[model samples]
Target: MEVKSSPYYYSLALLFILNLIGTDSLWASPYFQSGDSIESRREVIEFDESLIEAYQADEAYNYFKNVREESAWEKFKHWLSLQWNRFLEWLLSGISEGNFWNYMALVLKILLILGLGLLIAWLFNKYYVVSQKSPPADQSELNLSEDERLIQQKDLSTLIEEAESEGNYRLASRYLFLNILKHLKDYNFIEYQFQKTNTDYKSEITQQDIRSDFSYASRFYEFVWYGDFKLGVTDFKAAKMRFENLIRNIHNSKTHG
Candidate 1:
């Protein structure tokens, strides 16, 4: 019987052979010239000699010599020049000895691999691990315009009342202060975006000279909102005063400016 080969098998074998050849070519090629090789070797020898000389020099002797010297701009400039020369020498040595293109190619390959890996991870997370689970259609869409101010105010009042009644004074203070800030922003007394951390907002308003008032309120609010710290009646009163003062100042500034 005549020998026969499957076309699919042959094609696969050819592809595998081609890949092997390409890989070999990529790795085995001499990446530097002979002249460059000699120059690099000579430079390395010089560097080694210089390093040995420096190590043999007495550091204590050099420090003593410099101690008696007058501090002058010329001395500083000379020292800087010496440092610059050393830097340039090392830079040139590295370039002459290094496979620059190969290094760049390696970095690019690593980045490409990392990007692909991240893309795959994201796809897995989105599709397999935490697949989309839609909320009820009616509740999915938030009505931002429908009595939003009134709704926010009511929520704010409820939180305060609940905290006060339950003796959760910390919670009451935090909610009250945040509601004041929210109202100030809403009323254009202050230009601020919601969901920003207090630290970030504090930095923005630093030049406005409201740091003390704003920071006090923010710190108290943070303790109540995120920490297990208990708030006393005194602390609550102080926070309330700061919040009110902050709002008043912001509104006054807006009106004046």
Candidate 2:
């Protein structure tokens, strides 16, 4: 036998549904009330509009976005790189276009540059090296040979007269140089030594005019005495005058002092 459902059971089911709905409302009430008050009390912050505009307007403000300035070396490298690239491009274009004459011209230009460089190096070596090399031992008169002791032993005046009598002006010029050196040594102007250079003697001289005169005379002597060239009578006369002037200056300094 199947029993029919009662109205009283339906009323209890409806009451249970209503009670669940009211409980949910009770649990949500505090949250909604607090949220309303929090929203009502909240304040809106006002910023200075000029500060934002000024910062955005300043170009230097974006420090991290700045491009670095290239140094001189870096700029040169970049320029060289660009030139090399352009040259390669031109070379490729010429080759692709079958410009045989242009290619030959370029090769000739490079060879010409290399030849010029070699010529410059050869010229520098020939003249500079020859000037610095010690002259032949037989070139100096009296076999003085840069020996301070031998130079001091000989009478340079008598040697100069003999060299001039033979018309060996080169030998005469050498004697003149030795004469001035001897005078300086005898007067205690310079501490003479075989190992010392003319530059060393120049530094030892204290008088300004004497030092200047010595400098001119020393350079001229090195060219005439130590060089592998013939000194004519006219050249010897000029060199003799320079040496005599230096000697006179030395004498004047001693007399005045």
Candidate 3:
């Protein structure tokens, strides 16, 4: 061969450097370059073709689309069609006979369809109607209205004594709450009005401690009396104690102030 100088030597040196870097890069042909060209390499996506494939894949839509397809629904439809044709033929034959028996058969077929429809409706009502209906309201809680019926009497002290003597703690709790309201009214902290709700009373009281004490007594009275919850001796005593403590505290504050 001819003696090659600079060109041959430079080519050999370049190849040696590439080999040193690693032989892995040799596999990166134009065909397997990277995933960036994969989308471009794919066949053109036609909307019509994709839509057809999707429709074919949908079993439910296909079931109704191609009526001749062999499925359970088709089997049922085929049987029904066969029965209906047979019935028509029989009916025609019976009509040709010109007798009462043919009319009876037609009437019976109509009745059967109506009965089946009624049965389906009744089954739906039996299972679904109850869940659709709203439940009844609980009668255990009293309604705290704006009516003055809550603080009914002026002389609650006498009523309280009478209720205590009779051992009617529920009645006594009610009477005690009335007495608390009376005290508040006398103190000019709140005006006794039939139109004023419990919320009104709380709003009228500027003192935080008094409002808290009054709310407790008021709720207790409602739960016992209006709510129809029978208060036992121990329950009544606790309620009475709370009311008396609050009343005593209020009395002392007024006296000392």
lDDT of 1: 0.63
Displacement of the residue 36 alpha carbon in candidate 2, Å: 32
How close is every model to the real structure, measured as TM-score?
Answer: 0.36, 0.55, 0.40
TM-score of 2: 0.55
**Candidate 2, 59: how far from true, in Å?**
37
Per-residue lDDT value at 31 in model 1: 61
**Per-residue C-alpha lDDT of model 3 across residues 1-257, encoded as one tens digit per residue:** 99767888999999999896666665565666666576776797557988888889988677566446689988899999999999788656676767898878877877887999999999887545543443233353223451255456566678788878888776677668778887777676688886676779888887778889999887776566655566788888888889998887677655211
Which scores greater on TM-score, model 1 or model 3? Answer: 3
RMSD of each: 36.2, 15.1, 24.6
lDDT value, residue 115 of candidate 2? 100
* Residue-level error in angstroms, candidate 2, position 25: 16
What order do candidates take by lDDT, descending?
2, 3, 1
Task: Compare candidates 1 and 2 on TM-score and give the better one.
Answer: 2
Q: State the lDDT of candidate 1 residue by residue for 1-257, as single tens digits.
A: 99899999999999999999998886666764344566466643236788677866967546445346657987899999999998556444544557887567556666877999999998886554442332223332222243235335647767677777887786577567667667555654455554555676666564356666777777666555444456787877677777777767766664421
Error (Å) of candidate 3 at residue 252 is 2.3
lDDT of 2 by residue, 75-107 (tens): 999999999999777545555556878778678
- Per-candidate local distance difference test: 0.63, 0.78, 0.72
As for candidate 2, its clashing pairs are none
